[model samples]
Target: MSSKILTCSVLSALATAFLLDWYHKKFEVTTPPTKNTPRKPRKYDDSLIREQLSRNYSFLGEEGLGKIRNTFVVVVGCGGVGSNCIISLIRSGISHIRIVDFDQVSLSSLNRHAVAQLEDVGTPKVECLKKHILRIAPWVTVETHNELFDINNAQPLLMDGNPDYIVDCIDNIDTKVDLLSFCCERNLKVVSSMGAACKSDPTRINVGDISCTEEDSLARSVRRRLKKRGVLKKIPVVFSSEKPAPGKASLLPLPDEEYEKGKVGELSALQNFRVRILPVLGTMPAMFGLALATYILCDIADYPMEPIVGKSRTKVDGIIQSLAGQQSRLGNTEQRIPIPNNDIIYIVEEIFRGKSPISNYSTRLTLSQWDPAKKLSLQNIVVMTKEEQKLHEQRVLKGGEKLESVYPPEVIQLVEKRFAEEKFYSQFR
Candidate 1:
């Protein structure tokens, strides 16, 4: 009985101690400040920043490093790519940056977010980035905006600061289009990140114009949308040329249990915000982010790189000359189509992707009219190999055969889609 009474007393004492600690933490304030103490001015260790970036100074030279330190950059979309990019830029000596993102760190984001800790989950991504950035780059100025970047707020967020450069790491198609279009209209220097999802190869990544990027559907869509806005082929981007391994990755399918809840659209962050998530290889996004930072830093230091395009204008001229020859062979004495040289180049690079849609041949490609009855315009032209062009002329142009009769459904569908895109672009012209 004495032992039981001692146990009860000990439990009561422990509970009381726990409550006291909680109370102190929750409500107690520190000792009252002593009066008349002069507060010292806050001092930042600029020497430490220089020591931290000493290697950068050596590599970029003193003048180059100075330029980097003074340049202002705005990064939108603080997700996997954007987070890595922000940290890399800060480490590279960019003293001023504005980070824009409306997302909270989710449990799933732990896989690829550069500086997010488990404790950061449920916090805004921009806030988390700023917190960690100030720890390392205390001398740097970081502006955090925990709101989505859209047309409604683009002017003040992008233009008011006169940022030297803008980095676009957004993943949504519509949002990306809006940002890129705004940059192009305002002549703002910008570099964009293309799709890194489902990509596993680091070597396949390349820095190039949006029109030169291949094997990335996201880049293709962005390029097409930009073209519709009369902004063609100058916006730089980092994209993967590697084709996704077959059956290795895809959009995750919703389970039956999820469907039972009804209206899957409600599950998205916003309307048309991509309900399905693409499976990502975490390292790929990091590589893309680093590439973007490297590209921007070099540019800021006055050492810009000429990113490679898929086909040069000289190559386009050859294709155009070859098409003129084909028109001659078809008894059209004019030898020139109704389309302008610039429009023809756009057709070859942007629409046909610098290859034959029928045989996927990149070499010896020439354009032929899909339908002889239609006037030769952007919508009427199609790319084909030399042999394929000859056969098309014999079978369709002169033989009066329908496109459905000569081409398979897939080819027909592809040609139709290209024509529709050309028609859409015509409105902008």
Candidate 2:
């Protein structure tokens, strides 16, 4: 009985002590304020950035470095020009970067792309760019938008963080114009690239306002379009004043027996059409990219590059201007020219317009020169399309005639369809 009474007393005492401790913590009173202490700014050491970009410090100083770090740069395409631009920016201590591209690295891209490799084939360009940037400037904060920069996404992609510098290296004209228009409308700083293909002179490349640029086919096209939108001047561009040598204009081989698979890749995103493969000298894009980078960097440092202004009429610019003028005069003029009903005519039209008028095929046609003996035309495709396969089986059931094994099913179907459609449309006419 005595032991039980002692145990109860000890439990009561312990429970009371626990309740007192809980009350003290839960409703504890705080000390009154002693108010006048200033908060210390967090310490930062830029030793790595300082060391890496030490060479630039002599020219730009810490002020330039600060601006570069604070600046958010956006590179639109991750091709030869863009890849180099991103790298130059990163090397110059521009840490905040965003890349926008939708293309996968093709085996052909390695010739000019500074960051692309054999292993990078089939990888998205923006993803590959991020990896490459991280390899060199690991401290950089890179954001990638693995998408095409179109009007729909341009606002979101560019304005999300309010980029400081936008680089235009896109291959497509419409997209380029859209990006440039957006920048111009918002008064954003941007530098664009012109035709770097077929250009070999690194010394001739320069940077200037789009209005002041000369000798570049791309710059001329862009200028004409921007003028239509009332964007007359102040858009910066990197261009080459060197003219492509006289005979070098026709760089692509004739679509003879050899180049039947003409311009295999590279299709237009907007029109869904194939463009001719312009000859690209490997180093030319790199040179243009470096020039573009220099312009942007110098612009950031409050310094301007010594851009070459053309005094005489440039051969390339003169040709482009004449073509533009001719385009206006050719509007709805019924100047009939004799067109031979031959395979070559069809192939030539398709080559220039990016699609065959008869078949409406937007991709590259696997076409060869017509053999007069075989009685074939360029419209006579070699491969069996799905519709042709069905028609071939149906025609075989009629048992009228057996086609030669060498003749493709598509050719037979095309002939029948063309005749049938023509007869129907002609009856109405």
Candidate 3:
């Protein structure tokens, strides 16, 4: 009787298990899907994208909007500045972009990142940006690179898209220099963001050539490094002109336990990366990023923007003083310079674009008469390095030689092109 009972109990348990399994399969197959079921991806809608960008189209017009749609942009660094920049770019009708970043999102990033959330922590930043981009601009073609942008991998990362503009938001000094040096060497149009950390005043933000950037330590470091690499050409950059208040902010010290370890550098995310964190106000970087986007859009759309030229009035006077001294030594008694004192900055920055057309050198530059016979005027003044000016004095001005005889055809052509552009631009003035 006991044996019979045990066998019956085992049979009952087996039947229950079998029934449970069968019921699961039956419901899974027969039950209609609920709201929890993953839905198919929404199809791309061209009209929707256009309608969403209607305000941008209204602002930029048909030709500008068309250019924006066709343009490809590359953004290196998916942190504060870069994230905001790419967001603006996408919303403004940038159809294609390649985002390169080697960092994973951290909880700290939520304070400043454009689209990061609590769930995005520990994921690659480029992936986060791309995912967010798809949600708003589904038709946008996004290429992501989850790796460090260094000299070794920069070419492929930067050149693969054949981007019309490269926005450099990299914070690492060495990597920043490497990217800028590469772009400068390749003659690639790029705009870089200087240090926005430790700054809070948004009014001080300025966009100008890297040489003209002041009060930002990161810009100074980058400028110094680029100069070491023989890159003296003008590099457009968005930088803050506000000086950081002393004792207001600084790099956070490492924890005692971490400092006890001999390898502090190893503690960084990557080798040679900064272990200490710079205190960031968060809002400053957004301003920098927005400024970058505005500048790039204006540039792409052929919209005219006369940015505040980077130096102070005193600096402009210094340049004039240098030019005057050069003139005085030449012994030409033209009692007064034909060029207005206020117009010197325009001539140097606008007409010549703040660099010598001959060697592309930016330092020690001053205005010089292109032709001795022509009176000093907007059309006659040209930008040249001090050395080039001395040579011009010896050959063209004093020796009575023609410009074409002394300078190469390429140089003459570039100067002439600048003059022609000035002639057209002057109409607006």
Candidate 4:
């Protein structure tokens, strides 16, 4: 009886101790402020929150914009076209961009390029443009590559980012071809801008399926090369239909040293009526950039726009004709000129026979001529022909049905040899 009573007494004492410790913690947590202490109220910055909310809500109506914010675009030039494109893309809410360009900001670029400020003259274009993008959209993620796009590095650069779209604003034909071919082979959607120089009219620009002609100077060269490799049919391009202006003869030719050292004022004074830079030339790049952005947005919204076909002139005609002849050509094959091969002798003979004439050339070139230095190869020989000289074009387009092959084995061997020789020279340089 005494033992049981002692156990009960110990249990009571332990329970009381535990309750006292719990009570002390509870008192500390609920303690009221002393009379001398001052209380601080929670604060909210309404203006800052309102600003952020406004930006986010602006896109609430645009499902396309929301989709675009998640996509990545790789632009391969940072000059006039590229800078404008990047800036526009950022402003449109594209948060991811990879820019590649090896050029430095030049004084001449300040006239039209978006990011070419006076202070950025010597800075690399990629770096300067990236800084500008960050300033415009702090949330944007931009990667800069200060290098030329080439076969050796293009694949890795493209694959590294896994870009959803590629914009080609590059001027070099070889580089453009390399990138286009790479993109096509990888099945990546891409858009390209052809020569914007010497073009004045912005309305002439159009994007579309690459025509089947070997007549556009740049397009012809690209088509011929791609044809040889069976890649021509797969590539799509955007190009201008306006012809470049004719060359002018200068009476008082400046010396090379003087030409190189001329200031902006001096250069302006020497400009002849035949040679001038149009403000529209700069605007065309921006126009192309917008087209690229539109393509991206359309793709994300599941409303793909139809590719433009041929040059704008022919394309417009086709549209009108299609509306009229909609039923007659229901299953007809799309009309396209045949790709040409390098064979100067055959081309000349065909032209002399009146089977092919130079009139088939695109509007981009008013005059095309063979350069002995540049056209040593038969393939290049075809490229050097005048706009109206069509011996080669006739055989490829009309006589293709009758002719066995415009590019026989011998012609192919000659072209390969010339290309190898050119490559060898390039390696040493």
Native-referenced Cα lDDT, model 2: 0.66
Compared with the true structure, what per-residue lDDT tens digits does model 1 show for residues 106-223?
A: 9998999999999999998987887788667767777788888899999988887699999999999999999999998889999999999988877678888887776788998888
- Which tens-of-lDDT digit does each residue in 78-172 have in candidate 3? 99999999999998999888888999999998889999999999998987887788677767877777888999998887787478999999999
**Cα displacement (Å) at residue 47, model 3:** 2.6
Pick the winner on lDDT between candidates 1 and 4. Answer: 1
Regions more than 4 Å wrong, model 2: 1-45, 249-274, 311-429
Give lDDT tens digits, candidate 4, residues 1-429: 999999999999999999999976653324433421212211325454335435543643356556676788888988777788788877766777888887799887786688678899998898788667755565666777877788899886687758888888886767888888888787888877665655555655666656532223667677666666567545555566543322421124445675577653445422321123433446666676666656555666566578644332222333223222321332225342121222222233222221222333333221112222342232333322232324343454333432235445664454445444434433322
- Superposed by TM-score, candidate 3 places the C-alpha of residue 378 at a distance from the truth, in angstroms, of 36
Error of 1 at 261 (Å): 3.0
Report clashes for each candidate as comma-separated counts.
0, 0, 0, 5
Candidate 2 lDDT, 1-429, residue by residue in tens? 999999999999999999999975654323311221111211325786688789988788778767876788989988899998889998997878888888899998899998888899998888787767766766777787776788898787778778899999987777898899988888888889988888887766777777876557778888889899988658778888664433454346445643565554434333542355778888988888888888888889876456665433222233233323322343414332222333222223312232333355544322221222342333332222234333443453233335644346775455555434434333322
Give the whole-model CA lDDT for all candidates, comma-separated.
0.84, 0.66, 0.83, 0.57
Can you tell me which runs of candidate 1 are displaced by over 4 Å? 1-42, 308-429
Look at candidate 3 and give me any clashing residue pairs.
Answer: none
**Deviation (Å) of 324 in candidate 3:** 20
Lowest lDDT block of 10, candidate 1 = 33-42
C-alpha positional error of residue 190 in candidate 1 after TM-score superposition, expressed in Å: 0.9
Per-prediction TM-score, please?
0.64, 0.59, 0.64, 0.52
